[model samples]
Target: MINRRNMLRAGVVAAGVAGGVAVAAGPASAAASGKGWVSVLDHYRDAQGQERDDAGAIQAAINAATAMRPVHSVLVPPGEYVVNREILVSGLNDAVISGHGATLTLTGAAATTPGASAVLKITDSERFEVSGLTVVDNERTQPYNGVSIARSSRGTLNGVSVYGVKWTGLGVFDTTPGASTDIAIINCTAVGTRFGISTNGHDVRIIGNHVAMYWPSTAEAAAKGGVWSAPSDYYDGINVLTGSDRTTVTGNTITECGQAGVYTQDCTNLVVSANTVTGCQLRGIEVDGGSRVAVGVTVSGNTVVDCKGQINLVRARDVSVVGNRLANTSAARAASLIAVNVGSSHVSVVGNHATQAHPTFPAVYVIGDATDVTVAANEVVAGTPYQAPASVALLYRSAAGEFTVGGRLLATKGLGVGNAVAAATPGKVVSKIEVFSASGASLGFVPVYQSIA
Candidate 1:
């Protein structure tokens, strides 16, 4: 067995001609590039051989790069690097693992403790980056993440692809303090994994990623992928778990999932904007409270299609679902376009255009005792009728709901243009809302109104 002492004690290995690896400029320049980069092949070999794993060689290359100053990048060129265990990069600062056209495939080696296994793990590192890599998880069983960054600061995983894992594909976390935490996971792809992208960190950016290939709910689908912590998480796409703050999930495409596309629980000051979510069996976006209270979440400027439940907020506060376009197909399963359930306060479902497929489910459902709720402006109507007088909303237990946010409603002008909603509870006094008409009358009978101020 080749140990770490033996791997690092030996000098840099030269790229031999028998290796059959691709090198651009020649062996001398690639083996030890004095100009800020070194090839992993300089210390690794026999990746194609099944008898020996390339884990030790790859670890050696990374160790060499990190230990030697100015040689900060370990370039893994176009080849398969078979790894049996986690390639741990701890306290690695100002380094890069450039694997643009390379594959890091995990071998079918059974781990004694699969709970502590990952293909690549960057922990307690600063200003480190791993980009343009394809990580294939062939661990033969469950309980392994593809790439995970924990307790790290300013770490980035850009343009990476993770495939075939029962656990998280790309995960970022802030376990402890002392490190300045800011992470970015941009333009990544996760397919056939349990959780496409799971994060519970502050100051994180999850942008322009594609999450698909695992759909759990339908009978036609094979498997599921989703939230890492909760029991309800079956096949989630982008799950931001508890206590994450100042996070941004924008311009991503989440599709074909059993559960929520973008699910945020107990997160504060978060923004979910300009994303496209489609073909999710559950909600396109869900903002709910967990152990902590969820607040200041903005779900704006999104396009969602063919999702059963579009946007949902449960027991949340200071949340806004604004300027989004949600639509469903004619054969879509029945679900609400927007749902604001009990314990939600200071919530505004404003300036959104929602079109539902099934007439049974309303476009907007304000259920139970939500306080200071506002459903104003824009259009919410049935898609099949096309701007007809449709059952646009249902306000249940709204009249008896209390007012926790102490304030007056916005001065009502005329019922604005494109206000195409009919409250389903005819003759039910809807009084809990804060909005007031220009005639000093409470728009209480959110009951039979065709439009709203």
Candidate 2:
């Protein structure tokens, strides 16, 4: 019988060797993985026993050391190592830079100034994993970004905390003059920044992160104010763009942001599931453009409360909104699910519950030039004169093609709008519009304008 403990140790040893480091044979090594391990304080020491505070030590240990192979890990001891200089980490293929129990803090004179520099910059690396460290960017006082991971593939940041970043907490950019893949962020937190985590990478996964975007005070805004930024628009969550594909945002809690929780643009094959967004000033989830059919976007099992707009899909295609609960705390006219200004086709909305407690509006809305969008299997209920007009549903001004509506309720004082099937080429044959009720009963429907009071 292969013991689970032994299997874990063996897996670590295999990873160590595959990463280009030799497996060390010892009882202590067996605990984590017997491999070439270097201590940040001891291995990269000066003439005296006291370790150097230079960022060069870290770079030398990972990038310049000839004896230390790839797939090696640098262990930082438990202490505050203030980095006054800019550090660049360059690695390739399965390199690990880990903090055992130490705090890697970026310290500089800019912490008292208005313009500093980025703390750590990573470039031209692949299969890199960073864990168990607090990377603080004092750009609030100094004015700079915290950490940037650029041109790296298969990069993973785990149990990391980044705060006080001026621009973005974690900025993953495509700067290699080419493209990279496979980025994952797990158990990370970012606070006090323009954007918590911003990325332009493909195959990305952001899981279990806490982001709080606080507005700069009126005094601070006046001191360091600019035309490009305002007291609003500060986001503490994730913003993704630049033609990103195959992205998954799961198990995250984002609160108190000025703009949005998760805003995605130019993305394809995306999934935003199992997240909690609260106290956002603008919207919760927003998706815009893509090349091919932007399909398979599942927004499921999320709790979105106290936001102006809950889920907004604009200029996107092939979307599935399933099993979500939204509540608007303010008296805004914005619907819980608003497909405004989107020209997408073939959208399926299922199993979503919204409280139109907000005054004078519909709980759900399907507007824009969206074609063949179906609003089925949903529970939308609200009071009289309540804005969320659809106790059950609404399909407004949609370029009609084909609709499959079943198992939904439109609960409002306003009359429900029917599907408007547009012609193929303005003169071509228009397709038929179908409707089904909450109990699967077929309701023979007509066009919105034709269906009267």
Candidate 3:
């Protein structure tokens, strides 16, 4: 087995007569002026009358390209290239390792460990393009991430199929403190992993990808930290964080994860729209911790069903959650509470619908030191058997917090008895109650106003 780091540093040559011809120009100046293509099969030959192409021989070819002119293409032709160790596809500048209808299938022989099976490990290469190939990492000891891209500027993973990887199909992480900018994933299929596309890059766009997660059992959920941790390696399903900015998660179907479908933490300027999330064990979407720290995010136009909780926003600021539908398609556990909780201020939860709340829980629960939270234009029509509306529609239990609820349809208590502010003292000023609901409502004039009058 070749040490990937040493092979990368030694500069592997592309295999074959065409590769040797290309290398005859010397790896350094082969295509310094124009473009070049390095094919993997060109390096393979019958070793001791064996029929299969040798993995080490292929690695030697890739090793020779280390100091080659910016690789215009690192082509892997259609065939099963069995690897004994992980392959590092590293270089700098607008390089492309295109598979051009080639199948870079990961063989089961490399099942030495979780880290040894990945077909391609991309690093520090900008404007990288990987497409039209099938990468399979068949390891059951742990989930194998298909392609790992890091610190690469403007990376693209398009029309790629990743099979039998554990944690994620496509993963981009900023292991270095330095920021990775402008990553895009389009038209990809990731199966048999915890998450399809897992990213932690700035200006990331995850569009038009079919991402499916493994159906986790209760034990798997707990071991993997719950359904909210879908794509369950560390934190699943596009875990973008650390002040990464401008992430758009749109038009993707994310289902059956251990945790939240879309986990955006500490991001500046984020948007989750036109995405359908279902059968997730935990919250459907979680936007956490971007106060003044990570500002300007919106979660809109999403349909989430059968999730433990629809949405959980904590310590976020300037967030607009509108035009979303939350429904419980499962009868086992109640749909978890939908909340904009703790340290979050100036949030607008309008034009959203929630159904099937827990008997004792409200559809939308607001907690923590949140102030100026607006709950308006929402419809909470309780589930069957009880037409009396969700617990109170909205619960504001934070001490010293101000909430404004209006333009909502409620079937139960308009101003829930225990949730109202205590009556004002003789000279102190108090917030007033306002009700704007349809006529013929039972709680039109709440039977009891639990105020300290």
Candidate 4:
């Protein structure tokens, strides 16, 4: 049998031929000469090619490598390893665990019940990397996370896949007051978890990943709650929660989540851009201030389809929702395409395209003490007989801004200096503004300032 260590020791080399000409392969010994490479299969396996309960052997190898130097790498080759309990890798600096086609199949007590430990936990570590591995929980009902990193800084989780877990697939959190910073989750895929990826840290980058939550059938979705129930009861694709700052979630595809595809709560300085979100039971993307103030949030260049609501922001400040495309193809039961509500200020909704097949829903709805909002140059087309009283190209209640119709200001409203004005119609020739009172009574159109040139 060609075991992993023997294969590495033999330094297997292969040459390539291009156009019937042979080329020399690089030095075979150079590839296998890393002093820090330790194979887990060599030290802990049964006679029948089955991995033992050797979490301790893997930890021992890591400790041996790290004790000799500050940096090391542990190699896990292609096989299934059964881990009975959580494996801890703590207090290591500049360490890496690289798995090539390796799968860690968790079992036993921790896999049978909900516990505080994760399948693999890395804590109090810095400059770490875990890549090219798959972690799964066969007992899907247990609440074991695939990987948890807490109080760690400057870590990278690359090309990893995690599935069949009960809780979050990857969790990056900080228990202390100061935030964990510079964590990157790149090119990872997670599915069928409660949360695909979640973070409560700062300066995190989540890029080019595919994350999906459980997609229950219509009967199953209704049993959890209604289709439009509160998002707290359902799964989220990617979540950046309280006190997290300067986070970027971009270039990701999220689908089939029960809650918002990309959600932020009490998080500041967030950028959610270029993500494709679809078939969510709730809002596609939501940024809520909650008790803390969320500021400097930008949701741009996203495509959202077939969601109950899309792009919802509440109690946020200095937020920009720009250049997004949203569509509703079914009967709309929730809110509008874009909703800005309650204590939000300095918001800009610009250059978006929204289409609603249902006649009763609004394209954009803005209400409740929101100030300095600019809804400009959006193309919103809805079916006839709009049922929501506030359903229009631009709907505002107790919200004040400089309103424009086809690049012409409404002169009757007496535009104030520094009042932000937006051309509500993009391609159309006619421009109109229908104002409404707080009680949903129509105040009629503000007279156009002048005819278009």
Q: Which candidate is the best by TM-score?
A: 4
Compute each candidate's TM-score over C-alphas: 0.75, 0.72, 0.70, 0.77
Full-model lDDT, candidate 3:
0.62
Among residues 3 or more apart in sequence or in different chains, the pairs in candidate 1 whose N, CA or C atoms overlap within 3 Å are: 194-226, 225-235, 225-236, 226-236
Instruction: List model 1 lDDT by residue over 1-453, tens digit each.
Output: 232223322233222211122222222235355655666656645446533347777787777777775436666665577777788877667666766667887776446353356788878777777878888875546467888888887778888999876677898855542233588899999987767898888788999999984464432353223322234223689988887878899999998776788888888888999999997777899898876679998999999887777898887999888999998766447777888876788887778888887966676777657777776664666643221112223122223443222233334675311222444454453333334566655554333343466
Q: Supply the TM-score for candidate 1.
A: 0.75
How large is the C-alpha RMSD of every model relative to the true structure?
9.7, 10.3, 10.4, 9.3
lDDT of 3 at 450: 37
Among these predicted structures, which one has the highest lDDT?
4
Model 2 lDDT per residue over 1-453, tens place: 221112222122122321233334222232332345554433346557565544656555555322345445654434455666556676645655565344556666244232224566666777667666677655354555566677778777777778776677776767431265688888888887778887778888888888877543433444656211455436547877756778888999998676788888777788898899886767888776644345557788888886668888777777888888887756644555444335666677777876667666766666645676766656655542112222224332222454443324433543333444553443333543445554445476543332335
Q: What would the per-residue lDDT of candidate 4 be over residues 219-258, giving only the tens digit for each residue?
A: 4466766554543324789989888889999999999887
Which regions of candidate 4 are displaced past 4 Å? 1-34, 45-52, 111-115, 217-234, 384-453
Candidate closer to the true structure by TM-score (higher is better), 3 or 4? 4
Local error of candidate 4 at 16, Å? 23
Q: What global local distance difference test value does model 2 have? A: 0.62
lDDT of 1 at 132: 80
Q: Each prediction's Cα lDDT score? A: 0.70, 0.62, 0.62, 0.71
Which runs in model 1 stand beyond 4 Å of their true positions?
1-30, 45-52, 112-115, 138-140, 174-180, 214-234, 383-453
Error of 3 at 395 (Å): 13
